[model samples]
Target: MREARMSAIGKGLRRRGRLMAQAVSPPRRNPDADPGSGPAPDPSWTAPIAPRLVPSPVFVLSSVRSGSTLLRVLLNSHSRIRAPHEMHLRTLHVRLSRSFSADAMRELDLDRAELEHLLWDRVLHLELTRSGKDVIVDKTPPNTLIWPRLHRCWPDARFVLLLRHPGAVVASLTERRQDPNPAAVRAEVLDYAERLDEARTHLNPHVITYEDLTADPEGVTRGLCDRLGVDWEPAMLDYGAQDHGTFRPQLGDWSETIRSGRVRPARTATPGVELPPRLRELAKAWGYPEEDTPTP
Candidate 1:
C-alpha cells in the first residue's frame, strides 16, 4: 500500500513539473503572422550555424563607468589578446537604399541584419589579423544592451560579465554628468543593472566584480586568464605599458584614472545615497551590503 501511494505521488509531482515548465515557456510564434507586417526578423533567427569569421570573440558586457575600459587595456596588454577600445559594432547598420536592394540581398540569402553581421565579423577579423593576435576582445559597455543580437550574430561568442555596486555606479554617473538629475541617474543605473542581470542569467559568462578587480588585480586577472584559456602573464597587470589605442569620449572612459595607466581602487557606495527599491534589491543580489560598506 505504501509503495502504491509513493508511485502516485511521483506521478503527481511529474505532472506539476511539466505544467510549471509550460507556464514559464515562451509563447509560440503565430504561424499565420505576416512576415512583412513587422520590421523583418534577424537573418540568423532560425539559422544557428551562421558563418562567422571570428567565431569565438570575447565581449566584456558591463555598464558605462563600470571599468570596462580598464579591463580592455589590461586585456590589451596580453600578447595573444587584442582588446580594442569601444568598437560600437551595434551602431553599425546596413541600410538598403533602394526598395529592391533588400530583395536582391535576400535572393542571395542575406538580410540587412546578416549583412551588418558580416561587416562586424569582417571588421573583427581585420583587427585580429592586423594585431597578429589569436584572440580579440571587444569591451564595449553598450554591448550589454544588445547581447541577444550579438549572440545571434556570433553563436560561439564568449562573454565576460563585469559588475559594480549599484550605489557606486549611480554616484559616479551623477558626478560625471554636467547637470545631473538624481532620479534620472538612478533610473539609468537601474536600467543597466536589469539588463546586466538578464544577460548574466542567459549567458554562462565569466563574471568579475570591479571591487575585487581593483583590490586584487593579479588574482582577478589570473582567474580571467584561466577562463580565456590563456596563461596568466605578469604583463597584464602592467597595463600602463601597452598602447591601447586612443582613449577619447564616445570611445570609452578617458579619465585621469584610466590615463594614469594603473588600476585604482574602486570607491565604496556613497554613505547617504538612497537607492531605489529595485536597485537596492539588485545590489543585494550582487552580494553588496545594504549599508554603504567598502567592497574588498
Candidate 2:
C-alpha cells in the first residue's frame, strides 16, 4: 500500500511539473507550415450559438442596374420587411489597433472576420429595430462579390439572386459613366456577372429576372412573399406610397423610372449591339436570346 501511495505521489508530481513547463513555454506553431493546407474552418461555426441579432436576414445578389432598388422598395413596402438604402456593410470594418488585440479577440473565440460579422449583425439589428420590421433586406449589388464572407457571418441568411440581360446591364452602366470606356464597362459588368454566377452555383437562392419583375410585379412579389413566409399584400406593388428612404447615389437607382412611383417596363437590349463572346454566353445562359453576334 505504501509503495502504491509513493508511486501515485511521484506520478502526480511529474504530471504537475510537465503542466508547469507547458504553461511557461507553450507549444510553438510551425512557422514554415502552410496555413491554408489544413481543411478550412466551417463558415457556420458560430451558428450553434445563435450569435446573430437578426438571424436569417435577406440579401439581394445582383449586378449593378439589375433593378435591385426597385425590388428593395417593393419589399420595404411590406409591413414586416424593411429594405433600407445600401448599408455597404462590406465597407464597414473592424481594425485591430495593436498586435495583441487580435490575440485578445481570439482568446474570446473571435477573429477579425468574426468581429466584422458581429458588427454587421449589430448594424442590421439596429436598422431593423428602428424600422420596426421583422425582416431586413440588404440589396447592395456588391454583396454578391463577398458572399463567402457573408455566409460565414450569417449562415442562415437568405439570398435573392436578381438577374438582368448582360446587354442591358452593360448599356445601363455605360450610360451612367461620364467617360465610359466600352471595354472597361463590359469588363466591369463581367466581373459582377462572374461573382453572381458563383453565388448562384453555390446557393439555392430565389432567382428573379429584371424583365419578369417589371412585366409582372404582383406575380413576382407574391412569389417572394411566399418564400419569405409572409402574406401577399397589394401594398407591395404601390411602393411609392411608402417612404423607402431616398433616391440617391451609392444607395440605389435614382432614375426617373424608379421615382415615377410605378413599375415601368424593362428596357430591351439595344438593337445590333453585339455582346462580347463571354457576355453573350452568360446572356444566353440567363435565357436571353443570343440575338447579336459576338463583338470582335
Candidate 3:
C-alpha cells in the first residue's frame, strides 16, 4: 500500500514538473505566422473579417512573354500592394452568366453587374485583407483583352500596361517551345497589345515598359505608385526577401518569377522564326523598332 502511494506521488510530481517546464519555456509559434502577430491569415476568411472597398483595384495588363511575371514580382513587393498571380478572369462573364438571373439577383440586393462585382469583390478583398494590404493587383495578361468586361464590372479600377518589345516577347515564347505554330502565338501577342492600345481611348491607363521594369525597377515602380495613389516602399525592390507562397501561377508560366534576387536586364536571344508583317506594324505602334527577317 505504501509503495502504491509513493508511486502516485512520484507520478504527480513528474506531471507538475512537466507543467512547470512548459510554463518556463516560451510557446513555439506557427511558422506561417507573421512575427508578433497572433496568427497567419487564411486567404479565404479575410474578406468577411475586414471587407475591403477595392476603390482602386489594379490590373497588370500585358502580352505573354512580356516579362509580366517580373513586373508582378516587383509591384507585389510594394508595401500596399497585394499582387497575386493571374486569377484567369478572362472568362469571368461566361462563368458568372450561367447563374445570373434578374429576379434571383434582385432578391439578394444585387443587379447583374452588382452580382458579378460582388462575386469578384469577395475574391479580391479576400486577397487584400489576407495580405494586410490595401491595393489588389491582379496580374493576368489575358485580362487586357477583356478590358470592356472589367470596365463594366469595375468602372473605377485602374490598369497598368506592361509593354515589351514584340520581337523580344515573340522570341521568348518561341524559346519556351510550348506552342507549335509561331504565327498563331504572335497573333495572340499582337491581339493583346492592340486591345490595350484601343482600351486607352476611354481610360487613363498607365503604361510601363518591361525594359524599364527590368533596368530601372525602382524608378518605374515609384512612378507606378504615383499613378496608383500609393506611397512607394523600398521593400518593393527587395522582393527577393518576401514570402510568395500565396501567389498563383498565370497561364502556366509563373516559373519565370522563381528568380531569387533583384530584377535583371532583358535576355538577348536570336529568334529563328520570322515575325509576321502585322507584328512589325505592332512593334511600331508599341514604340519598338522593327527587326529584319528571321535567320535561317
Candidate 4:
C-alpha cells in the first residue's frame, strides 16, 4: 500500500511539472492551423524611428554682377541643397553694428552666448524654414568682404567664390545710371578681389571663374561639387527654369540684371567706365583683357 502511495505521489508531481511548463512556454501552432489565426500581430509592420535633421550651410561670396545668381541657381538644383538669392543678412549685420552705440557693441562682445542664441534661434531658424532646404546657402556678394567674421561665426562653413573679369564687372556696373557710386563700386571690386586672395590663404575656399562656368558649366560644377564634398547632380545645370521672382529694392539698378536670366559674355573691356587709375592698374595686374579705347 505504501509503495502504491509513493508511485501516485510521484505521478502527481510529474503532472504538476508538465502544467507549469505549459503555462510558461509559448503555444506552438499546429502545422495545419488556419493562415490568419495568429495569437499576436507581427512587429515588423510597426512604424520606424524618426530620422535626424541635417545641417547644411553653404555660402557664395562674390562681387555684384559676377555671376553669383547663376551659381546660386546651379547649387539650388541639388536635391539636398537650398540656394537662395542674397539674404543680405551679413549686410544687415554690418549696418546694425555700425548703428550700434559703443556700449551696445561692448555688450554684444561680452554676451556672445545671447548673441548666438538670437542669431541661430531667431534669424537662421526662420530662414531655414522659409528656404525649404536641408542646407541653407547665402549668396550675398558683399559677404566676401566679411568672410573673416563669417568664418568666426561658422567655422565649418564652406565657401564658393565666383570670379569674373574685373573689366566686365566694371563695364556692367558703369552701364547702370542709378549706381550710387560707379567709381566706388570699381574700387570696392578691386579691393574685394585683393581681400579675397588674402582670405584664401586663411581658408580652403573653392574658386569658380565666370568664364569657365559659362563655357563648361557641367565640368565646372562637377569640380565644385567635388571640392565642396557634395554629389554632382545634373539638375543643377538646368536651374534657370525655376523662378526667383522680383529682385529686392536694395539691389538698386542691378535689379534689372538680376531679373533677366542672362549671363553676359566677357569681351574686350570698353573705356568711358571711369574706373580709377589704381583700379585699372589692379585690373591689368589681374590679367584682364585690355580695354578697347574708342577712336577720338
TM-score per candidate, in order? Answer: 0.82, 0.82, 0.72, 0.63
lDDT of 3 at 41: 28
* Ranking according to lDDT, highest score first: 1, 2, 3, 4
RMSD of each: 22.0, 11.7, 14.1, 21.2
Candidate 3 lDDT tens digits, 47-160: 111232676688877888787777777777877788777787655541223222444544555554455566677778788899998888887888888888777667688988
How much is 111 displaced in model 2, in angstroms? 0.7
Query: What shift in Å separates residue 68 of candidate 1 from its native position after superposition?
Result: 0.7
Lowest lDDT 10-residue stretch of candidate 4: 46-55
The C-alpha stretches of model 1 lying farther than 4 A from their native spots are 1-49, 293-296
- Give candidate 3's TM-score: 0.72
Of 1 and 2, which scores higher on lDDT?
A: 1
In terms of lDDT, model 4 sits at 0.63
Candidate 4 lands at a TM-score of 0.63
Which scores greater on TM-score, model 3 or model 4?
3
Cα lDDT tens digits for candidate 4, 131-236: 7766677787777888886665565778877777666677766655374676577676778777666666677778777877888888998998887677998877
lDDT by residue (tens digit), candidate 2, 237-280? 99889998779998899988899989999987777666778878
Give the worst 10-residue stretch by lDDT in candidate 3.
41-50
Q: What are the lDDT scores of the predictions, listed in order?
A: 0.87, 0.86, 0.71, 0.63
List the lowest-lDDT window of 10 residues for candidate 2.
33-42
lDDT of 1 at 270: 77
Residue 57, model 4, lDDT = 64
